[model samples]
Target: MANNLQIASAAYIVMHLLTKKKQSSIKKRRWWTTQIFRSRQLYNGTSMIRDLNFHTDSGQFENFARMSQEDFEHLVSLLTPIIAKQTTHFREPIPVNERLAVTLRFLATGESYTSLQYVFKISKQCISLIVPEVCQSLIEVLKEYVKVIINTFINNSK
Candidate 1:
């Protein structure tokens, strides 16, 4: 048992060493290590930190309700324009990659909050803040685009 555990730990350390250079240079190594440690603590024995990415607290993300794909795309379109404006105004909002990941997760699975935390590698609190803001932005700015689609749909239904 001890030998197997040692081998696994050695393998992980090797992988982490290789990946770290490609990932980011650690300026404050201690701080980054400490932060990572604390974040892992949030799992409270639930998360399994393996060789590569840790799958922590994965959960099902069934939509409480359902909607058509058109409705979903329209929602995304509605927010895209507004997101540009709002994101620009902030000195530095969440990074674009993070934003894209969040948006894609919502579109893909319509996941609940906890599943999102693990999948996106973000805190549940952060997800709480971002998802709603994006949703509102989508609704407000895509008025013309949505209107055109809605009008076309109405005509087709006739």
Candidate 2:
């Protein structure tokens, strides 16, 4: 009878441990999912993009993004149609200018996506996606200028 009780107790302890382990795993998963979908408002509120009045501070803007404000605005205008996203009910889309700024900063600084995420309040995943998409858009939109430059160079050489 004692041996049976010991066996039963061991079985109960094993079952309890398994239940606790499952619960902890579920909790971890919930936390991870919440993190993935968490609001960017907190980060955005303190983000460099929001805090810096770069428009008024052209020098600072140039330092940060490696481009003058005028050129930045021009790029934004040219790229907006290609990069712009529609706002959804869940969240407003990131602005075109912000996307361009992030891409330019990445190009200028060669900062890791993790660091950029902190500065821009955008997820690294989003940054990774934004950088490549913006770069491709820039190539497509700027190919005409490249061609003109190449043609001028060849003509001048001749």
Candidate 3:
């Protein structure tokens, strides 16, 4: 009888522990959990891309991004169709222009995703995903331009 009681008690303890472990593993999902992510719009006005003032200061913009404002805008336009995302009920998607700017800034400065997170007011995880996707899109969109350039060079050589 004592052994039976001990077995029951051990089983109960095991069950209780399992239940507690399951509860702890289940995390709650919330929209915009961090203050920094929520303040992205407020920081946008003072962001590197905007504060550089593409029209008024092309030299500064070019220096910062390693590309002129026109080239930046042209790249944005070319990649927009491929990279654009739809806004959902939960939140608006990050704009294509912002994604391109982030990728270009990363390429130009070789800054880590963590450093860019604070500058762009975006999460490092999001920036990590954005950079690769934008780079692939750039390669895809620029292929035609590359082909044209190669063809022109060949014709001139001949």
Candidate 4:
């Protein structure tokens, strides 16, 4: 009876080892799953702008946005409070700098929604939602600045 008990214990150990080996050897094709694919989707906000050196490369940045970096900063500062209030704490708020850059790119280049998505690594739905919101915010924030610039331009032309 002792030998029988020892044999049963050895068989159980062997079976457990085999099960672990099989589990480890099996290649999981988890990369093909929707969850994995979704996780791999690119997200570009503040870092994208920084990586592209929009702050440092004044010439390229101005060419892309049709506005100087100083003006861009001013616009972002003006719009920050409004956009900040609109954003909730539920999810990460896209930075005011990114929103302003994306809006300026769209307005300056007349780029399509699809193109903007590729450029910004943002979803089409989000881009569509953001563009209008930023535009409206810009109108509200820059109204006074626009008036001053227009007045200066008219006076200079005289």
**Which ranges of candidate 2 are over 4 A from the true structure?**
1-39, 42-47, 148-158
Q: Model 4 segments beyond 4 Å from truth? A: 1-43, 85-90, 147-158
Q: What is the model-wide C-alpha lDDT for candidate 1?
A: 0.54
**Candidate 2 per-residue lDDT over residues 1-158, each given as its tens digit:** 99999999999999999999998876433353245336566666225654566658647677777888789889989998898999898687888888988888889989999998867778889899999999999999998886547777889998
Off by over 4 Å in 1: 1-93, 148-158
Please tell me which predicted candidate would have the highest TM-score against the true structure: 3
Question: What's model 1's lDDT at 4?
Answer: 100
Q: In order, what lDDT does every prediction score?
A: 0.54, 0.80, 0.85, 0.75
TM-score, every prediction: 0.37, 0.66, 0.74, 0.59
The residue pairs in collision within model 3 are: none
Runs in model 3 with CA error above 4 Å? 1-20, 27-31, 45-47, 147-158
Q: Write the per-residue lDDT of candidate 3 for residues 93-154, one digit (tens) a residue.
A: 88887898889889989999999898888899999999999999998999877654777888
Error of 4 at 90 (Å): 5.8
Error of 4 at 136 (Å): 0.9
Q: What lDDT score is found at residue 8 in candidate 4?
A: 100
User: Per-residue lDDT tens digits of candidate 4, residues 1-158?
Assistant: 99999999999999999999999999978553344224323556566655656768648667767888788888888888898645576545667887888888888878988888766666667779889999998888778666547778889999
Cα lDDT, model 2, residue 60: 69
lDDT-based ranking, best first? 3, 2, 4, 1
